[model samples]
Target chain A: MDRVTGHGADRSSGRRPVLTAARVAGLVGAAAYAGLLASTRPFTVEADVVTAVALVAAASAVVVRLAGDRSVPDGIGWRPYLPWLVMAAAVVAWELACFFGGARPSHPTLSSIYDIVARSEAAKAAVVLAWVGLGWALVRT
Target chain B: MTWRSVTFVVWTVLGLATLVVVALAMAGRGRIARPSALLFPVSTHPVVRVLVVLGWMWVGWHFFAR
Candidate 1:
């Protein structure tokens, strides 16, 4: 009951900021992406593109929400995240290109990209950039 | 049931089940609690990763296998 539902104020007192819709959306997008990646060839490249777009959009929504959230100040040191934001967009674009380039089964480059998404230069940089941004938020007033 | 049909249904069930469980679990936890507390903290971590891996493997088998 109370343990499962977390129906108290302390639930909001975690080290991290409260969960925002954007973050939730990002989680949903990730789950969907993972689930969809499993399915084989009946789907077209367009579907992959759609999945990528949805993920990036979900992530972008989180960024936008964070930026707009009143608790976050205008001069928030994390503002530098906007650049990483651009980089995130670029990563998604690269992913989309590789993923949807060919017709069925997608291009090898796309598979390679995903193969490394768990660990890739581009992916690593993007993830680092995001971490730096969050660090900025955490360290700043 | 055949393997193909079973795989689809498994994924379908897993995907839907995770969502329903997550939703109810999340909602059950007031929608504001950290997911860790809502779900079993230990099982939530590694099991989620395993579930993701297994879920995709199942989907791949469903889509491309002969």
Candidate 2:
């Protein structure tokens, strides 16, 4: 007998997908990170660091899960969505930091390290390429 | 060595290690695609998650928010 799974997989096994506590925690954490980023403005340095760490940790969790390790508790297979979540979190953080954190008038924010590099065309290109690489890696399932 | 020097050296080593890993991943020349099994404990442990989140908040408060 074939059993249809939410993943659209037909398997003979009768096991149904279950949502574990860990999975719920990860999803909630990702969502909270996104919400915080969206509503917060001129984030403090603390906010920047927390958001960065969360983004990195979530990304790592997703990577570990996708690399075929059963370590991360499966929850609706949310690992695939992690990269997008990370990217969104990062973009929001960056924009908020840049716009609100930047010094009054023309000075860039202290966290705007990219602005320093952007002064050099080659460095700017490198940074842009790095962002592209990051996007590519994150989007890969 | 001075504390600053020590910090510089440590950062340099870490930077080089990161570059090497990135290079390997790009080249598709190694089996480093998957994180080592050692990460399992950190990833799966509940206490660790709480501690990490707490630590993150602490760092943000102390260092970022003046």
Candidate 3:
């Protein structure tokens, strides 16, 4: 059954359907990240890994769900996910490189050298949580 | 009681009280799709609503933990 709104399309009125759970979830995720762009807070290295899990979960909801939309925002299916996934990867790598490069020069506790290592490990754990959450979203009563 | 003891008890009661109030508020709403009622039926939502409210609590805790 279509998960968006339980009721399928009505044949008579023919209005465009509302967003599905996946689509709305995806849209909301994108919007949330888009909002993050305006944040003035200094970016820390841990953010990348945390966002990776969040990014995947959000993107997956949009891509997999979006109900019948082959594409949205004028981009065809799966296209929108590419940039986010790539950006997340690049951020992770960037953080790692920065951490390794700065480890020698920075304060032991204040710098991101420690953050990079911590983030990567934490990101792994977050991925597990995302998986569980996604599965719960799927199986939720 | 020590300040630590009092503090713990107060916060615990506050947390549980919050939960109870939310539950009561939810119950007062006849059902989802009923905006006529004062209380919004949050439990009927697709789990995300509950999670979102809990997320707000988490944010509150995260910010207030210090």
Q: Candidate 3: deviation at residue A64, Å?
A: 18
Model 3: pairs clashing at backbone N, Cα or C within 3 Å: A4-A20
Distance from true position, residue B44, model 3, in Å?
21
Stretches > 4 Å off in candidate 3: A1-44, A47-49, A52-141, B29-66
User: Deviation in angstroms for A62 in model 3?
Assistant: 14
Which clashing pairs does model 1 show? A5-B28, A5-B29
Name the top DockQ candidate: 1
Q: Candidate 2, residue A12: CA error in Å?
A: 17
Among all candidates shown, the one with the greatest lDDT: 2
lDDT of all predictions, in order shown?
0.41, 0.42, 0.38
Second chain TM-score for model 1: 0.40
Judging by TM-score against the true structure, name the best candidate: 2
Return the candidate ranking by DockQ, descending: 1, 2, 3
Q: Any runs in candidate 1 off by more than 4 Å, and if so which?
A: A1-6, A11-141, B29-34, B38-66
- Local distance difference test, candidate 3: 0.38
For all predictions, the C-alpha RMSD in Å is 17.3, 14.9, 17.7
TM-score of chain B of each: 0.40, 0.47, 0.43
Ranking by lDDT: 2, 1, 3
What's the best-to-worst order under TM-score?
2, 3, 1
